[model samples]
Target: MTHVPIRVGIGGWTYEPWRGSFYPPKWPIKRELEYASRHVSAIEVNGTFYSSFKPATFAAWRETTPDGFVFALKASRYCVTRKVLAEAGESIARFVGQGIVELGDKLGPLLWQFAATRRFDPDDIAAFLQLLPRTHEGIALRHAVHVRHDSFLVPEFVALCRAAGVAIVYAASADYPAIGDVSGDFAYVRLEDAREDEPAGYAPAALDRWADAARTLAAGGTPDTFPCVAPGRAPAVPRDTFVFMINGAKVRAPHAAMALIERLGAEPQR
Candidate 1:
């Protein structure tokens, strides 16, 4: 049995509610990342979406997390929220060069999230995808796109992502459409429908479903439960997978992530 790595995590660590709930009542706020990173295998850095960080800041982040813990950066809004994505070359260049290399081996994929109004234009998207650099400061870079518009739910859009070797973010949201099509070498998922009443964010049955889906993704198989624009699933080559708990009942995000990690046969940080 080939078991590829499946990292279950949540969005950024900082939240006023988490100060007392997820974190210890008397714990230092500065060490929140350290605590959160230990519990979850990866984190989607929402802060990077709005602003760039210095090399020293990224280095300090790398120092806080343990080895094998990954950090997925949200690509700057300057790169994706625009009338013409092809013209985002300069913004992409600036975003990529913003001292992200300091994260070194801890760096993961860059998530380029599109606005709900951003429609699918094959030529424009393909051009934008072409602008993404393969490497930055000698380290390899991977990219994922989260498109919210219903226009993107087409086979042509999936083919564009496949041709570009960029992953399509499988987001579970009430307002946004979820695509199960796999285009890149890895699978990235955002689970956004967590509940406040459930201790694990998701109920036991729902978590079980997600766990199974994640295992399938790790094996390079797309979940049949999610709507797919493409006809079939990706090849069954073992690959790394990232699943993040986001939005909904935000306070239970960490607990949901840890629960998923445990379901995947991995022990969460105590």
Candidate 2:
């Protein structure tokens, strides 16, 4: 089956610049999102866990942004604790439901970012997985399982996700084992900046190689993997792709995204 266009975005809003030339300016949330939307189609909300999503904020977000934009929310800490796993279905359900309601239709995916100490407990994982409702009929929902510490990305986990019909997120970080065998109509790739000295965006030479590889992967249904090498640069694999680079200095997401769009020869967004 033909896949949807790969939707690429960044991790969050705002960035700190090292140079004194461009100082950071305080802006409204909607304005920030609207500015981001000009280049990136989506963003991952890391702050969602730090604070609850008020209904009013969600309304403002929907009102200020254009249509066809997306947001990926990180699940709250309370929803994934050891206590919640012990017969706390109501709590988890309410949390997820509230997140969906607050994010509304623009919500793209729910990221399940596990703690560093949280290991792979088959029973716990299954229990947590069962608590979530399936993706809505018209909406696309992906449950991204991110294990911070050592955890097995075993075939069984991939099988469970396949059966459940949830897209698993694959983050390309240095020194991390590449998890394969994910089954879903869609997928997510996070390219975090690994090189501190390098520029805070995509590297041109690297993009040349990755773009070719991505096209090759798209031609066939074979499995492919992309790893973060630098800002805006990832080793592209075959198949549909959505890459979000999280390394930017003073709001460089748009610049990096524009670079990638030009590298891919894909239509520019703005």
Task: Name the candidate that leads on TM-score.
Answer: 1
RMSD of 2: 5.9
Q: What is the TM-score of each candidate against the true structure?
A: 0.97, 0.76
What are the per-residue Cα lDDT tens digits for candidate 1 across 1-270? 123289889899989898888899988989999999889989999999999889899999998888788899999999999899999999999999999989988899999999999999989999999999999889999999999999999999999888888999999999999888999999999999999999889999999999999998887677779788888767789888999999999999999998898889865444
Number of the top lDDT candidate = 1
Clash pairs detected, candidate 2: 201-231, 202-232, 217-238, 217-239, 218-239
Each prediction's Cα lDDT score? 0.90, 0.58
> Residue 11, candidate 2: how far off, in angstroms?
1.7
Candidate 2 lDDT, 1-270, residue by residue in tens: 112355567777654441221222555543566676656666787777665766677677766555666677877777765544546577556556563654556677777776657766767677777777665444456676666554655656666665665656665566444454444555656665434333535567755654554454454332444432122212343445565666433245545555666667654245
The pairs that clash in candidate 1 are none
Segments of candidate 2 deviating more than 4 angstroms:
1-4, 18-30, 83-88, 102-104, 135-140, 194-196, 209-241, 247-254, 265-269
